[model samples]
Target: MKIIWTFTLMMIPGVVSSMSVTGYSGGGVNITCEYDKKYKENTKYFCKGDWLSCIDRIRTDIKDKWFDDGRFSLYDDTRSAVFTVTIRNLTEEDSGTYHCGVDIPTGIDSSTEVKLKISTGQQTRTVRGYSGGNIIINYKYELIHTNHVIDVCKTSSDQCFTVINTNRSTEWKRDRRFSAHDDTSAGLLRLFIRDLNENDSGEYKIIVKVSEDYSFFSEFDLDIKTDDCCVKSISLSASAGGSVNINCKYPQSHSGDVKFVCWRSGADLCAKETPVNESRRWRDEGKIQLYDDREQQLLTGSISHVTEENSEYWCGVQTDQGHKIFITRVLVSVTDTVGPAAGWPVWMGITVACVTFIIIIIIIIVLYKIQKKRINCRSAIDEYENYPRTDPRTDPRTDPRTDPRTDPRTDPRTDPRTDPRTDPRTDPRTDPRTDPSEDTYTSLDLNTRSSDLYDTLTTVHPRPAVHQ
Candidate 1:
């Protein structure tokens, strides 16, 4: 059994300072040391060991020296009075005590000491998460105050672009990959890393800048996993003339596999395929970049100058035998660069649509109310038109006059005795001659006939005495 023990160098005296750096056996780091202004023009050298018999591996002269020895590079800045040394592709034998010293004319020269520890980290803690999932790493060390500074980095390398400082709000927020929360009460700092991929798997260091008095360091290892298929379908939206980068994941076992993208028609594959090496392949109009990362087993692609005319394409990989195996279908929607309302942005168009919908509903409601009001305003005369079966004769106002019985056009007068000539309604019982229906002609003729007959009868009675 092999046991590895690490010790902190804070126990050393003589203006004491120490920093512990942890890294993987195949990984690298950069060491930075600060000095007083008096050491500005002094020659800076990096050595491996205690002050006495330390091995002089590399040195720097006073005149802005830059030293490069393959895996190691050293730079001494005379103005800042600081020197930095970078080591790459390290191994277990490379781990040891290192010191940054300056050649001084006076007494014992000044130097800063640090310890480098290398391990495969098989004995340390680890975590696994999906490609698109998030991971929370907890550091339980107590903090001095809210002012405690913390930085999370992929490696111990100095000035690495992957270094994210928690003290600066914008630095962590700007990078979509990282976020942090400090729980002052529990003395716990939780780091949230998102949009993870296989490349994110590695050793990570946590640095705490407490004060000029001392500094603290902690390390964690991550082992990110993926689903069985590794890659899933992706849908992307962009504006006309914009660009989009598509990333797909594969297992490390599938290294050197041929990646492909082609147009698709329904369930059938289109004959035309895009060539990755060519600058323009997507419908002969898109500029594309294809990169295969053997270490991370990730294939990323970028399409530039995409318009709405660019459409459905399949992203896939070829097997060792060169058979195409599609993993995901890519749907790219390039929207109109200019919105419905001229010069308006996407949000403004959405707002206008909502407002338009509301206005339509209000207009419909107003029209319904207007129709109801017209129905309520109808007069009784108009309502009567609905009943066509009713008889006008049954109505007493057939003449539509107030008094039908004594109406001047119908009866002329109410009383006939007033003036017979003016009163067209004079009664027949009042004057016999005016009774045309019964005795108008017969009444005058009967009287004359009877008188004539009686005179004739008297004369005929005397002449007829003998016949009697």
Candidate 2:
């Protein structure tokens, strides 16, 4: 049967009048049609269904591709008198006759018929699993009277990973973690993989016996999720020179075997430095103290006088007496105690600033008003003092003391001091001799001088100077 099937496939397309092709349902196939050189420039086409009358079409001269004709495609090369036809997503209904034709202006066009057979089989179904879990797969079919042999092989090589048969007495055998079973009456073949792992995910080939020498194969893509153990982290805040207490606890599990702790800076992973409990304690007692509380499943560590350098720390929990554990990153915020102002709430600080600004604005407005009023009053006083009421008494041109005469030296009666006519003291009213009361008082005073004054007066009055 194998030799006959191979010979049949090798004889395809040997004759130009007709050919036969094979395709898998839900798969694709390509076929080539040859013609005489004289039809190279003529119009070429791909026609589907009955050769006498076809519905699906692609014209070579119009554009050589038939992409819009459903899943059918045709490419015509006029220079070589050859056309290639490609079909995709084949179905059982697509198994029929198809024509590669050339258009002739006169009479009917010549064509070659192609017999297509679309063989369909079951596709491999997907199965998923996580690490540390079991996965089961069934490869079953209808019961048939043929020798039943099923082999599940990895696609990477031609080797059976697990095999199942109806004749073998020792049927179920285990290889690695894989096992298989066969139910001949129900046409069922099942496979089970215990404790699936990440590396088990890949392409697997399922091969089955269709005949004594002929068989079919399928493929499956398996994907297994990785077992993830995420490390958790936490944050803490403390003042400088203060002590901090840390606790690491986890959910209840199969074992309360957690008994260790570690600490580190910068990176978040803990560094286990303490020895077993039977040995001595950690020598660095002043800075750190660690304890394990089995009753409460609590692991505690205390750090004294913590500074900014204590910012990065790692706390961890052990799930077993061995090295299996999980860690958490610790972030400590070490700050200083500021003054009392630093404790003030946000709203209070804003309120005080607003009030101070308002008071300053009011004071500035008051001072500006007072200064403006002073400047206005001084300006009014200066304007009034500048124009002294235009009084004639102060004018040099109109006052009597200012004199109407242009030249005082030309005045006719000017005195020695101011008068131009006579001596200032020669006025009879100013002379003592002209005053009768003045002569009486003067003649009586100093009797001896009066006698000489009277004799001189008598000589002047009597002797007008005898002509001498």
Candidate 3:
């Protein structure tokens, strides 16, 4: 149907509050608005845009009956004192401001604005399950539309065929293969499909009815695969001294076979090496253990205290006596103590703390020695300054020749050069140059006097005070 979505109404006032609603392109959305009980019998309408230039799309005067227009519908539940407006086949242009209003006989209508946002991209999800297994898918709806019909369908090129629906019962089952359960309180629809085969792999969708012509949908892709003897390869890592589990899948036909694990080394491809076979209970061989879950069709091999020796292994099945078929190659690596599941080991922390403590001790010892050396140097300098030293040139008491009090020659009273009375230049009577007549008398005395008397003559007269 060609739906015209725009129509103008008279400008109104008194828009109190607003709400937000979200929908996807090509999907539908429902908006539930609450009103006072006094307006239970009043006409309720839904419109687009703001109050000044609002365009009314659909209005209903009858209570509890849905009134439909092109792409829009309105229903007023008088008992609940609320009105619901549903918009179908939403497009990008339909996303804008809308209003849920009740008409009055007086001043203006009572309305609450709604902001609708339509996403251009459709949300799709993917799920995978093994053949002969079961899968469960869940979808949620708005609380107001929880009681509406919910259906699960498988899609073809252009159409979808309903597999199960909640129209007949809230819990519906079909052909023992498809089932649906609608949880009203949680607003969840859960669909279950069991005994999955390769043919069950396809695109499926969930449809939630909002109105007679409007419905919301979400699509998902389901991939189902047939079981092999085991997976091709698996890579796992575990911290050293930790443990790991290697799970291998097999077909139901080999569920009765002897499941085992062996080391794959050099050129032996697990043939020459002994296999750790499964027993009735968990059987341990060295560090590895094997367990067969017949009901789950799985062979689980567990290695404790993983090391480099546990690096390469294989998942095998012994169909004939003394013959094994290695199917999956498992490559394991031993990591450090720091890993996602396994945190740092206790020994590592202790080692780091010990090294840090030793370093701190060494630093303290070095600092103490430096401080001691500085103190010793300061002490030596202080001792040198306080020590007594003797100098003959400065201290007269330290040397006898320079001491004037101890040496008679250095005394001013005994020294003739320093005493004016003992100097002949000061006495003219003893000096012969003062009296020339005394020169001949002095020569006669010098000629007649002995060597001892010459000292007395030289001492008595300074002899004109010779410069020598």
Candidate 4:
């Protein structure tokens, strides 16, 4: 006995006039319908319905019947009018016969049938790209029944690209992974690993199948690192009247095989020395020079008679990979003095001698004035003793001879000369010998005691006295 089952389908108003099935349970199915047959002028079989109308009808009426528990659902490419049924979460219960049918308005209808048989094991496939624009495919593990094949489509620009797998041991095993054909490409095919692990870090092989019989392959390695280059430290030093030196060291990771070294001050790099090149006189305004050279060590050239102008001197080094720089400064000053040309001790002695000479001249002038006063007093006394007597008759001041009356009676004991007033043969007042007007004393002979004595002796003693 045979049992027959019939399922009724429903349609949405105004949008759909027909229904059909596009794909089935174990993956082999094809369905088509007449949405716009006028698009193909001679295709009279598909003349009446719009494309959206046909798709809407299939989605509404047949979608529930095709559900197969939770394994399948309806999909439509709205831009292309292609309706598809996708199977997922597959199970053995989903296997069945599918009927696709479309109802025409003039009492006519079209139908097609597809059979589905679900397999018990998993089937695997891979995608790859190749050189010369080809894709290579190798399928492992047999399916319970043959499944329909479709090209791996690039939704963008509708251009088909390829991928490749080169491991022969896993060529027939569906567990093998997929990879791009060439590691380096003119256009890169970026493979994004969601949660990358250590297993993701090695070389990857890519193969591309150009046609059913031809293929290409390449390999590439990926390396991962966690550390970066760093500057270790820098230092500077300067001495009086000398060039400053600056030292800079970078971490070993960054300094590994330095090719060349350079020095700079501020933004300008110092000129280098060569075998044929002569040294530039006073280069960089006499502020910089080449000092030393070697694999990793350097020194600055000697700077003579350094001055304030060199205060801003700097040093630097350049390596194969990077550059480092530093600066140092030096300061200088000189001594000075003030006062008299001679030292203070010599000036003090000269000032003292000048003061002593002036004091000696003042003492000599005081002694000379006292001696002159005594001489003047003695001369005045002598003039007083020689003054004539006051009586005019005997005063030499009147007759000028034997004038005892005119001469002063000087004390005999004091003067020791004979006093004119005490003469023996002369009268005090009237005697001729003593008279003030007589010439007796004036004419007296030195052999006679007096002129009167001579006259009397001659008269008394007679003429014989005169002859004797």
Candidate 5:
């Protein structure tokens, strides 16, 4: 089952190579190598500048001169720098040291050494079958080395090498219920058995010898089981409106001595024993009822018109040794029997309507308040339109006319002293200091005729009204 392998790589001026060696049972072995670069021109079976070309030349020379057997060969190509040497069809006698070397014209040379080993392969076999049938065996042989091969045979005529392992060992068994077959080409070992019995359970050994010093051995165990004396438990099935069957099976060996009893618990306990078919204990509030007592150990309980309230009942078995119970506490809800309440939907609808009505009322109140404020503002503006503003500067109460001298235009009749047209107010002579009122008229003085005319008018006064 285990293999050891070794790989190595080396590089020197103008040359690079890698090698791998594997060891297996039966002295089988393999050696492989790869070169670094392709060969160039000026290479007569060996290129001076190319590393792989030099390696190819060395590989060809070694195959032809050292190991020229049919199992050894060399592979090389111009497109790939890689050069490989293979040794196939390995055997115990083929294990030895292998070397690959390369030489360049520029005084550079590289070489690698590999040691090949071989071992006897381990022998193993596999057998498969049902517990109650005959056992079958298969054998196979595997070689550990590349150039090696293994062969297995049996010592007795009754049984031959039914199976072999990787070590090339022979597997043999003396059991009459089992048989084995071998395929040498495919390295497959097959086993066959008919009417397998329970007693055929044990380990079988395989022995193999390669030459005189090399040998391989292996062992395998077989087990068989019978299907008898099995115990089966009870299972119960029930539905909403239909009855159920509760069944239990006792061991066939104890069918006669075993007694069966049925019982129910929860709210009340009721038990019925076998043989007598009499109820030993009973409590009733319609709590627990024994529906059917067939065979005593198994019972079929019916809950007529099963309802949610009666779903918490328990059913089980009771015997002289002990008691077993099963409680059904799952509340069975029936969709047809229970539905939405009659007034629930109606009440919900009314509630939603009321909520909507309240919202509308609130909106109306808000809008009314807004409109009322607008009307009040309009009325205030209308009332303010009737009033007119008065200027304080032109009002009579604060007028300068209250002071007669301060008035720029005064009534001419009211101020006789200041009148310039009055003759009595003026002085005719050119006297500078005649009168204060006539001082302003001094410049308008007229001749004595003008003064005489004024005196005549004064003297010619009209007659007063006689009859008044």
Candidate 6:
């Protein structure tokens, strides 16, 4: 039974027409399916997989109008007898066999099988040019696609809108800056772009259609660099009452040329006073001083006492009589405060350094005073411990008149040594040796009472034999 089924399947027609399409991931594709004019009003459907038992993706009921569903869109051009299907934002998973079918109620329907292959590779290249220059780009394709529609476009946001294409005549001159030449025998498409500038730097696409609706493209990134003629948009700043020095560099070949600093009114017009002769020493010319250092290939100009009126100036080298090629543009700004061109003004940096130095000095002074006080207190304590006070007249405890044992007014009942509140060992205020706070004050008190303490300890008196 399986062998018979296989034989029967082989005998059936797979598809009435077939074609292959190529697309890139993250891109889109358009597929045009041509059908007979007799089925113009019939319902059409686009499906996936085999045409006989295909899964329907989109079905159109209207004629000559587009029907959109998700990423799939279908349009039936009844007059041309062809319908177009568009798939957007394609991925590798979208690569499969699809069938464009026309539904018929009577008998078999008409179907066209489409094989889509999605590739994941970059087809881009880099082409570089200079400012104020021209460039030519040549794209090669298979000779079979030479007769197909070719386009050159600027790619932006995944769209390749045409700039120049073969849909027009071979001698098309709609845009003078852009031109195209189709070399059919060599299978080359040559594109010429004249007088390139910075704004022209971007990605360009060359697309060649392989089928009625499907085409592929290659990308080129154009990079335009600055020319040696001049440096553009240079900003320099100076104070309102000060002078500004303008320094511009030129090529070594122009070392012998006369350099100048003049006011530029137009592209090639220098309006202000003519610059002085080139000299190694500064030569005065009106309010400006000019110096041309040929050995260093440098042009130096200085404007003294610049005001707001001295804003725009050009530093250039004279190539011939009454013609100068500007090497650099100078935009001078006059302001009270310093500008960004000179970062962190000198006065501000000096003030910060002085404040930091003063803080460091104050820290050192505080630490030195604390260390000296500690050393002095230590020496006073050691000296006060070893110094003696053994004299009877000076030492109040050795005098009989002041003795508590003999004097009735100072008896043991009132003696400070006997009463706990007044005893030297218990009373914190009376006994300086027992209290740590009192000991701290004693070191400090020595600074003011050192002489009185020394006088009491040094005074002498004779000892009594029997005082009590």
Per-model lDDT: 0.60, 0.57, 0.69, 0.32, 0.39, 0.69
Candidate 5 per-residue C-alpha lDDT over 362-408 given as tens digits, one digit per residue, 9 for 90 to 100: 99999999999999999999889976666657766566675455653
- Residue-by-residue lDDT tens digits, candidate 4, 395-465: 55676454554445433432324444454434455454445433543466667666577566445432221
Clashes by residue pair, model 3: none
Best by TM-score: 6
Worst 10 residues of 3 by lDDT: 1-10
Sequence-dependent TM-score of model 4: 0.21
Task: For residues 1-468, write the lDDT of model 1, one tens digit per residue.
Answer: 112222333333222455666545444566777778777877777788886667766776745666876777778877877787766666789889977777777766667776787655222245555565444566655433455676777754444235566673422232466766556666566666655688888877665555442344555577766667575568897667666678776665556666666665432343346544322223222355566665676667666556665656656555432334445567788877733343333345569999999999999999999998888777655878776564555665563564557675566464445657555565554443465423323344644666665465444432123343
Candidate structures ordered by lDDT, highest first: 3, 6, 1, 2, 5, 4
lDDT of 6 by residue, 167-236 (tens): 6345433355776766777666667675568888898877667777567666667876765744544688
In model 4, state the lDDT of residue 27.
32
lDDT of 2: 0.57
Query: For each candidate, C-alpha RMSD in Å?
Result: 19.7, 28.9, 25.9, 33.7, 35.4, 29.1
* Alpha-carbon TM-score of each model against the true structure: 0.33, 0.27, 0.32, 0.21, 0.20, 0.36
At residue 245, candidate 4 shows an lDDT of 32
Model 2 stretches with alpha carbons more than 4 Å out: 1-90, 94-122, 157-170, 227-468
RMSD of 5: 35.4
Report the CA-based lDDT of candidate 5 relative to the real structure.
0.39
Q: Comparing 5 and 6 by TM-score, which wins?
A: 6
Clashing pairs in 1: none
Across residues 103-141, which tens digit of lDDT does each residue of candidate 2 receive?
778756777777777776444545554555444566545
Who wins the lDDT comparison? 3
- Cα displacement (angstroms), candidate 2, residue 300, comes to 34
RMSD of 1: 19.7
Q: Please say which candidate is ahead in lDDT: 3 or 4.
A: 3
